[model samples]
Target: MRIFAIGDIHGGLRALIQLLNKMEVKDEDTLIFMGDYVDGWSESAQVVQFLMELSQKINCIFIKGNHDVWCEEWLRTGEVNPTWYMHGGKETMESYEHFSNEDKKKHLEFFETMKLYYLDDENRLFLHAGFTSMHGVEKEVFSNTFYYDRTLWEMALSMDNGIKTDSVIYPNRLKHYNEIYIGHTPTINYKSYLPMNAVNVWNIDTGAAFFGKLSGMNIETKEVFQSDDLPSLYPNESGRNR
Candidate 1:
């Protein structure tokens, strides 16, 4: 049984479908999604609907993202967030037009039920963004840290490669997990189109919101799977490029 951690979807349902097809997931396999299921392309509602159905068929863990927070709020209260609207939220809002109020309610429940973070049996940590507490996720102070923090990844990137795990200067946060997986900060921003590792922290987000493709990584084998770049699949759409 394989265990895979999927990156941010960002409404690229076509890319997502292609990547999943390439992965050829099995019934016994477990999927851990790193969130940001909406916001970017034109199929936000469709992506949510697919994930909801997918979860019902297999073992799946969904992590909530900041973009998801905005989308969920809009679905629940019909109040649009200005920042979200500016950043692909308009497309997300518009995508729901064909759906009934009942469908919207079901989608809202899916989002509401998502976890902020997930810790696997192996002690690996999966979260949308980062956590600041040196003591680990359980000690996180900010309610939004799970989906909004970047310092954890930043610290990992800047950490000296020569520092041994047992060294006194090693980050206390890194010691709490066997491995840490995250997806908020796209690896494409760093010019890497594949999963990137800075120490034990692995970033699976390959920038599907823009020019990159949907990505998924097998946590056990470190194997990566990705779709064609989002632009290629949806040539007519800008997909949050502006």
Candidate 2:
């Protein structure tokens, strides 16, 4: 069976569907979604709904992202913080307007059930954002760090040749896993629109929430599949400015 890890979708339902169709996923294939499933484009509600249905058909793992935390707050208490709204939460809120109370509850339940990070049997780590350190990554103290940190990627980016022998900074950073897959910090920031690899860490979030493609990487083979540039799918929208 094939194992795939998908990056931040950010409400790009059209792109998500396109990529999924391209993958031609089989029932036994496992799909690990590296969060930020809402808050971009115009279809946040639809994206969540589609994933809910998709989970029933296949082995699916969902990670929670910062945007997802904001989404959960909005759904649970109707709180609309400006910071959250500014970063695509406005679009997400609008997407839920037509939903019935039960439907909202279903979506909320799905969001609440999402994990901060997932570690497979093969020793690969899948998370929305980076971790502070490899030590205690599986523990509860690192739960928020799993979705909120970016230092790991920064270190990966700044390191030469992606290999670190000195364990002074982060003792187990390089030896902890076979590979690490993350989203949140888009690859566009690196001036590339494709999934990027620095040593064993892979940043798959291709900025679908910000004029880039939605990406899916084969975990075993590291092959990539991507959708069209997201803005091209919706000409009128500017996407997330921040």
Candidate 3:
């Protein structure tokens, strides 16, 4: 079966739809979404609904990103970190103007049910964020780490900051795996994949939330497809960190 892996959507439902339209994916094809489905754009709720519906029509593997984790926590505790709010949570909250308490609860439940990582029989690993362990243990995967260990979160943050090297600490020891697909880190170019190191880890985040293009990569072919009208939201590229 052909597998198409998509990057962090961040509520860019229109871009996603456009990309899917262009792909002309077959029913037998598998679609793996790397997560960060909510926040950043104006249609977080719509994106979630679309994904929920799409999950039924195709073989879909949904992994949770950092933004999704914050979404879950906010729903459960009614508390959110300031950094998360600044990043994209505010826009997500704004998307659900008419949502009822029941609707909110259901959405949170959906987030809770999302897998933090996915591993295929082909040994391909898909995660919203990178891993922390060097042993290639299943428990080291984000699915288990996020729920059980805070150190994993810290490692992700450190990697982002360039304070730590992922290659050194968690060498791509899963040599048996064909590739590890990840999101969360926006690429300078949204239409292509970015490599974190010499490892076969692919970062497909097209930064659609920032008006950049949405992207999809065919795992077998490494072919990329992008949505039209997707351009860098910020001309200077300075606002991306915001």
The whole-model lDDT of each prediction reads: 0.95, 0.88, 0.71
lDDT of 3 at 103: 83
- The window of 10 residues in a row where model 2 has the poorest summed lDDT is 162-171
Give the TM-score comparing model 2 with the true structure, all chains together: 0.95
lDDT of 2 by residue, 1-242 (tens): 99999999999999999999999989999999999999988899999999999999999999999999999888898889899998899999889889998999999999999998888898898888877655637543657777888988887887767346554654366568888899999999989999999877899999999989999989888899999999899788877945
Better of 1 and 2 by lDDT: 1
**Residue 142's lDDT in candidate 3:** 43
For model 1, residues 145-229, the per-residue Cα lDDT tens digits are 9999999999999998789999999999999999999999999999999989999999999999999989999999999999999
Better candidate by TM-score, 1 or 3? 1
Query: Candidate 2: lDDT over CA atoms?
Result: 0.88
Superposed Cα deviation of residue 85, candidate 1 (Å): 0.2
Model 3: lDDT of residue 155: 41
Q: Which wins on TM-score, candidate 2 or candidate 3?
A: 2
**Model number with the top lDDT:** 1
TM-score of 1: 0.99
